[model samples]
Target: MDDSTIRLALERHWAASDAGDFTAEHDIYAEGAVLDYPQSGERIRGRANIRQSRLVQPNTKRFKVRRIIGTGDLWVTEYVLTYDGAPSYTVSIMEFRDGLVVYETQYFADPFVPAPSRADLVERPGTEAP
Candidate 1:
């Protein structure tokens, strides 16, 4: 698929996710797509299985996309997933075939407080440095 097409597909996917619309979110996956959650050691094969797995999740979640970057058939999206008011940073790497996602691996991370020693080197989002 062309760059613009892939980008639009990704945007639509994320938008569906943010809206908590599982059907629309999973529509971009191919029938035999594979999804991997490396952190959880889980591999969900087939688009149907992936959709079912997400449908059973109990958390009330939302996605805030930070960035989406790639070319050709490989793409990576970084986003913050908020579940029950707790945010988890996530990265999803996808490989597409014929404009549909065929293989994907996702990683999730919890937020951590900034270390005191590095306070001068980094800036926090809302607080002003003293």
Candidate 2:
């Protein structure tokens, strides 16, 4: 997909999420797409799994895209999510093929620092557990 197309797709996804429209989201995600939320310890594989997993909480808020950078089939975006609590920063990396997102990975950017010093993944309960 082109840069604009990818941006539109992401915007539509977030719009549907904020509006609580799962059907719309189903159409946007690729058939085999996967979603990983480390903070929530949720890892969903395939569009169907993602379709079933929706944030229905009344207080879960919206995200504003700050920037989107692309190179070839890879697209990266930085965004801010505002909810009941403090806002959070997120970065999304997506790989597109045949004008559709074939792979995607997102990382929490705010209040989340890697290396230096921190607890290991083993200490985390469900996510690291085999």
Weakest ten-residue segment in model 2 by summed lDDT: 116-125
Note the clash tally of each candidate: 0, 0
Error of 2 at 71 (Å): 3.2
Q: How well is each residue in 7-92 modelled by candidate 2, as lDDT tens digits?
A: 78767876776566778856766788877776777777888777666644456767777877886678887887767666778887
Off by over 4 Å in 2: 38-42, 56-59, 111-130
Q: How accurate is candidate 2 locally (lDDT)?
A: 0.72
Q: For each candidate, C-alpha RMSD in Å?
A: 2.3, 10.2
lDDT of 1 by residue, 1-130 (tens): 7999999999999999989899999999999999999888999999999999999999999999999999999999999999999999999999999999999999999999879998789866678766
lDDT of model 1 at residue 113? 80
For model 1, the stretches where C-alpha displacement exceeds 4 angstroms are 125-130
lDDT of 1: 0.95
Q: What TM-score does each of the candidates earn?
A: 0.94, 0.66
